[model samples]
Target chain A: MTDNGPCPLQRDAPGQVLSLWWASTGQETAMTTSGRTGDEQAARAERLPQRPVRPLHLQAGALALVLLGGTLGTAAREGLTLVVPEVGGFPIALSCINLVGALLLGVLLESLARRGPDTGPRRSLRLLLGTGLMGGFTSYSALSLATQQLLADGTVGRALAFALLSVVLGVLFAFAGVLLASRRRAGGAR
Target chain B: MSVAVFILLSLAGGVGAVARFVLDGLVRSRVSSAMPWGTILINISGSLLLGLVTGMLGAQLLTPELQLVLGAGFLGGYTTSSTASVETVRLLQQRRMVLALGNLLGTLVVGSAAATLGLVLGAAL
Candidate 1:
């Protein structure tokens, strides 16, 4: 039941046209080809107008926001440093934060995925808080900390294995999160 | 770290994330092939920058400000596993699991390997 009219998909920039050439028989040669010029011109080429003073505004806003987030993360770390002893002899307190964040993100994602996805608050929470904030906060820096500790204890093999496993498992757990979320939705649909 | 240093890191991170968003948007606007080249490119580039930063810092060529600019700012903006994961789920729901899996595993494998490479180069320096 599909008609053969050119599927008019909206281009990003206004006043742009896109027409795909499927037939070499010349039946649909009326569009896309530059009528006046023999050159097979590009189907679409229209630049979106740059916003006046947009870069300046964006630069300022971005600087402010990054400063806010970085300071918050850094201050939190500083406070934690005052509260807790050195983490695995690294003296960096945020190492613990990253580890704890990763674990919590994993667990929370699991629980939310179990709830069966219907685009609820839980799903959004898992997506935003668990995946975005937690994943962002938890750095590979912490994993290196643990690995360093293992090696420091004269367990080179353990350190190597830990290095390999933490990375491999981190990805696997992330994929597992996707699977769980999808399955939950499928279950609900059924 | 002083408040100034803290502000610098945050400022850098914000700019980085926004840059990532803009880059992805620019790419996606043209290529709707469902391949997500933007994510891949951003991540790989981020890893490389991270490597460069690590090497420089280890070599004493970079100060804390440079670290914040590149490590906390640029790489932070360049890489995004969370959005990639969420997008994968959305794709899976729409029965596009192959790309999803590729993205998930690809970022992890590549990102980790890149980090290790960076680490080695850093240590060497």
Candidate 2:
């Protein structure tokens, strides 16, 4: 990539985009209240972090990796669903897919970040794992729909249990992944 | 799921991920907010579509293969829980309690609501 330290554009920086918007809006309000004119406001905006202008090649490479990874992850999920399917109106297959994917993602990100500065190979790897594989593997939408369906069917207890478990397991697994990676790193260093 | 179905699911998933990436970027470019509207929109719409597909399949208005392709494959790739969870953690770290809570609660509540609406509509059809 362009070597801007792990390429924020490539990383799952959705939160970054949101926060940026909020910061800019707040800044604009401050500027307006301070009697700064349009020119002054523009000058202030110039100092903020401008969006990275990624080159065509890097963009294309990332896109290709994402597509490849997404295909694999989705197919894998489908395979699992085939074997497990839903039982008792509960989507055991989806739950397993999401939880496992979340754990893997945590490990992937932790290991990748610890490897070194996010540059050529590292960036590509992150794209393949974070954006492509995990992105495809763990689905928020399906989980929501499945939970909602249970709710619709008056299975309130089951819906709540599934939802709570997903969130709790997701966070805990991610933490475990980070811990495991750190331990590996420490051992390697020693 | 058959071999052909698996292949189709893979293709659909690739398309779905690309669609998510494109739509997220488009929203980010067009709108500025602390709320992460891009992801929110993506998750909500994906949930609705998945719910509809699930409903249709359940009602036998659609086939199982279609459900595998659309609901499990496309929607699965399109909406992401890992990223959402990580974002929530990041917000918490930044001490943006309101926004963090909003992101978490909003996604759950609104996404579930959208799915419910979709299910109702699909069942009605």
Candidate 3:
């Protein structure tokens, strides 16, 4: 690679260097492109694996998927809230939603992990379910608000119980989901 | 909520989730922390906004429709307990006890404070 003489563009932006590499090497280079900003570039370089830049169309498609999933998730949450009355200011509905969302998220992740790092459909599915649906369904703000109200109403015990229960149950349900997925996988294998 | 309100709520939720994704991605891309600063920031900010909305609603400065759109829809989607819980557990699993405790306790402490502050500001207005 050094025999090609000083690749001045190498020190230039990785994106620019990539274009130059294409011009010179006439083949796709393995070197990764840097992010648009310097800080992002450093962070990206540290965590992300070297890969070709994604096309704009693909990114837009993923965004659309996430939006659709989010809408459904939020609608479900609101619908539940409307039906479930808060007893003594305890947000039973919100806690149930969070636990269920965590469980589903765990299941999604476990199943996706089996397929490994993905492109196209699998990646899109991950974003739609994990980032959009579950994120929308399980709300931190509502939990915070409920807890705040409980405290304000002088029910510190209930508030503390609600907070601790939400965190503990959310994690436990997620772990249970993962275990369920793994058990199913094992059964399928047998 | 009416059908129209539900529709608006759904649309707002979509926007909020997209905002969360974009904002979280932006923060994660900039910060190199194992503590999940992105989720923590998003949760705290969302809590503050929700508090403001609640205060405004209590003051009767805003309609229920607006509250549904901005509060139950947008903030509800933007702030995620599931991610926070999962991330904290992940940190614990990785043996980063300090980070795990920080994420769990920090989010709750800051979120509550921010919400209360927003409520006060909203009520003042």
Off by over 4 Å in 3: A1-58, A186-190
Candidate 1 regions with alpha-carbon error over 4 angstroms:
A1-190, B117-125
What TM-score should be assigned to candidate 3? 0.80
lDDT of 1 by residue, A110-171 (tens): 55555445232343344335433453444443343345446657877766665555444544
Candidate 3 residue B99 C-alpha distance from true site, Å: 1.5
Backbone clashes in model 2, listed as residue pairs: none
Please say which candidate is ahead in lDDT: 2 or 3: 3
Compare candidates 1 and 3 on TM-score and give the better one: 3
Q: Per-candidate TM vs. native?
A: 0.50, 0.75, 0.80
> What digit string (tens of lDDT, one per residue) describes model 2 on residues B1-125?
47898899887887687677777777877798766787788899999998888778878899989888898788888888876766665566678889977887788888998898888877778
**Clash numbers, per candidate:** 4, 0, 0
Alpha-carbon RMSD to native, per candidate: 13.5, 10.7, 11.6
Give Cα distance to truth, residue B93, candidate 3, Å.
2.3
Better of 1 and 3 by lDDT: 3
Worst 10 residues of 3 chain B by lDDT: B84-93
